[model samples]
Target chain A: MIELNHVTKTYPGASQPAVDSVSLTIPEGEICVFIGPSGCGKTTLMRLTNRLIPITSGSISVDGKDIMGLDPIELRRHIGYAIQQVGLFPHMTVRDNIATVPKLLGWARTKIDARVDELLTLVNLEPGTFRDRYPRQLSGGQAQRVGVARAMAADPPIMLMDEPFGAIDPINREVLQDEFLRIQDKLKKTIIFVTHDINEAIKMGQRIALLKEGRLIQTGLPDELLNRPADEFVKSFVGADRVLKRLNLLKVRDAMMTNPVHCRSEDSSEKVLEQMVKNDLAFLIVTDRDQRLLGYVNQYDLRGHKGHAGDVARKLTLTVSPERNLKEALSQMLSYDLGILVVVGEDGRIQGVLNSTTLCSLVGSTYDEHGGHWGRITAAGRIL
Target chain B: MTTYDFIVRNWPELMSLAWQHTVFVSIALAIAIATGVPLGVYLTFNRRLADTVLYLAGIMMTVPSVALFGLMIPVLSVFGHGIGTVPAVIALVLYSQLPILRSTYAAIRSVDPAIIEAGLGIGMTRAQVLFKVQIPMSLGVIFSGVRVAVVMSIGIGAIAAYIGAGGLGQYIFNGITQTYDAMINAGAVAVSAMAILADFMFGRLERTLVSKGLRRD
Candidate 1:
């Protein structure tokens, strides 16, 4: 565990402390994100942990030892550090870069080589293809991966990252965030991550510590901060789309209605119409014998049809998978004017259906889960 | 006599003078590199001192080679080693300083601050970062500077013959005194060949020394 007790940092000749008297504990095997706007001391806090910048007052203890007493060089070698710019040594090949810490520790050549290959593979790069290549040869995303690999080269138990994916484009950023989360699930290394992006904090951090002007505003799970922001600054910082962002963390299956009203492809049109009316539905999904979604038929499409629903069923080319986030499902529904989206499993079998109402209700309950104002949302739900 | 006939008749003397010229330039360049590189590296950490030192070196470079040589003769005369190799060498070393020093300083400064931070962040000591990271990356630029100094030194060493320091410059100065054009051409051709040869060799050395990732060609 890393604990900071009333830590403060004031640069030379500076009136205001960059990091104020902030006290926090980052439990081992958990990712604690420091998130705030520019000049909020989020980066300064991480630098303080590694003693990159000396603290003006208070104490920091890493793994139960006062870090101030420890040699900064020795402390840093044992803690992984990655940053926004990546800061890769351009003159060194990818392999040598990853082997930096190990080589610094005087690891044998063969051991360093093996560690390099293992780290490259861990970051999902083909060691054979990328090991000899320089940082300049790698793409932005690839270089970020290598930066991650280099940080983990010595398998340090605590990793400090400051917007490691901040420089990447959005699409690649999401991919890398997911990839990093997947790796973290297995490594379970204690991490202190810093970023200005709340969305990224929500997606990547298990717990977030929000700061403004060097003061710790609040520290809790992403939902806690979202549902109950400490102040107006946080609420505005999270933005007006806070509910929409909450939906991003929720999966399609979480909000999807299983055992939805669906009709077999060969079901008679009259029988489907009766089922739809009984269930107060305007349309029914038509599927094949294996429960694979073929299409759907609305009341208008069924009018004057004398055969089975499949005969008049329009192909629902747009479908969502159960693994997709609710935000993606909602956007698809909105873009396609879809009232409900058929959720397909990996095997192409219909698992459930997602409607906007159900998704909204799911998002509403999240407020309730975090002890926020759920009554207002419930009233809104009823009005909707 | 024709230039070719003069070369054949006095080939032994020409070879000896050329050897002396090589010796003078080699010693001056060696001393210049030894002194200039350290000074440059030191100055990188002290900007105020760097400005004064670099300015002095730049001013030294603007002094005409012949005039600097004349200045050195008088200065060395006080030390009782006047009008020979000592004055010539002192002039060459001073002349070579600006390029060597400037190149070293620029190369070291050109290294990315991010790379240095990464090095420090990853637990490299200051010395480790300097030797293992900064110096290696800046070597290509430093070598280019060394190449410039060497070529320039060879040309200037020929002029040192005026102060009675023996070299290919003796033929040029001697020929001018004797009003012999062939002798002057022979000396000029040999000096130019030596300079070109030094440049080519250093170019190859740079390619071998600099990391492949940093090489543009």
Candidate 2:
């Protein structure tokens, strides 16, 4: 675990401290993300952990050892670091660069080679394709992957990444972010990630520290932060789409309406009508044992069918993944002109149906009267 | 022997003398680059003295190379020297400083502050950030400055011929008074070739320095 006890940093000749007296405890193996607007000390706080800048007062320690007392090189060796530009050593080839920290620690040549190969595989890069190439040979996203691999070279328990994917194009950023998440799950390393993007913090951070103008605003898990922000600064910082960003964390299991009424394609229309009437639901969601949605049959589509509601069932365009973001579901609902979308598992098996009301209910109890920033919900269920 | 044959036979003599001018200019450029890069970097952290120091460099740059060489003669004479190649080298070095200093200062000053922030955020020391991040990123621009300095020093060193400092310029100056095209062409070709080679090498160095590729900033 990393702990900061009232640490502060003031650049020489600056009018104000860049980072004020702030205390924090980051648990081991948790992804702790620092987030805020520019000049808010989020970056400064991260810098202090690595002793990139000297503290004006107080102390910061990791794993019960004072970081300040450790040699900066010695301290950094134990911490993996990746930055926005990647800063891969241009003078070195990719294999040699990724093997940097291990070499520094005097690992055997074969051991370093094996470790480099493992890291490349871990970050989803083809070792054979990238090993001999220089950093210049890779694209922005590829370079960042190599950067992360280099950082993980010695298998440091603590990793510090500052906007590692920020410079990548949006599409590539999403790819790298997903890949990084999978790697993090497998590694379970203590990570401190810094970014100006609150969305990134929401999606990537196991815990987020929100800072503003050199002050610690709030630090909490993603859900707790949205459900109970410390103040107005955090609410606004969370942005108008805070509700949507929060939805990304909620699974279809958490948000879906379970035990939905079903009708089979072979069942008679009269049979489906009785079932819909008995269930008091507007539609009978049809599915096979595998739960692959054939279509949904509403009261209107059922009237003309000779067979059961399944025969007249209006084919659903597509199903959403159980892990898909709530905002995406809302978009699909509008695009398909349907009140509900079937939730599917990785194998396209229907988990449940999620309508507008069910999703909102699943998210949280409305506290609009408490006078929060999200005063309206015009974007379907989004409290914009 | 034909005129061309005689010249080609004596080519070693001409090139050997011209090689001294190349050595003289190369030394001057080395001194300028070594001194100028730090002065430029110091300007970044020591902002208060930036303009004043830069203005002094500008003044030094403004002096006519020939007049500056002449002025250096007495200074060198007092310092156990004479009106010869030493004065010429001092003048050429002064002429070379402006481009290196200007480019280094401009390139580093314009570097995206975001890149530096990212560097520090990831645990790199300030020295590491400057040398590893900032300096390397600014290299393409800095290479342009070094190119200017090298070319200027080499071209200007040819003026040392006036002080009787032996060089390729000797042939060209001699050819001018005596109307010998062979000598003038010889010096001009060597001078142009040196400039082209310096430009090409620095250009390639710029590409190698950018291992991370062109950053968004």
Query: What interface RMSD does candidate 1 have?
Result: 0.7
For every model shown, what is its TM-score relative to the native structure? 0.89, 0.75
Candidate 1 lDDT, A1-384, residue by residue in tens:
899999999989989999999999999999999999999999999999998889999999999999989999999999999999999988899988999999999999999999999888888899999999998899999999999999999999999998999999999998999899989999999999999999999999889999999899999999777778888988898888887888888889887777666788788887777666655667778888888889888888877678898899988888899999888889999999987788999898888778766777677744354323312212111000
**What is the lDDT of every predicted structure here?**
0.88, 0.78
- Candidate 2 lDDT at A210 equals 90
Show model 2 residue runs off by greater than 4 Å. A10-18, A85-117, A131-138, A257-357, A364-384, B1-16, B19-57, B78-80, B83-155, B168-217
Error of 2 at A188 (Å): 1.3
lDDT by residue for model 2 (A188-241), tens? 999999998887888899999998878788999988788777888888889766
What digit string (tens of lDDT, one per residue) describes model 2 on residues B117-151?
54454445678778876787677778888888887
Relative to the true structure, candidate 1 has a C-alpha RMSD (angstroms) of 4.3
Residue-level lDDT for B123 in candidate 1: 92
The CAPRI-style docking tier of model 2 reads incorrect
What TM-score does candidate 1 reach?
0.89
Cα lDDT for residue B118, candidate 2: 44
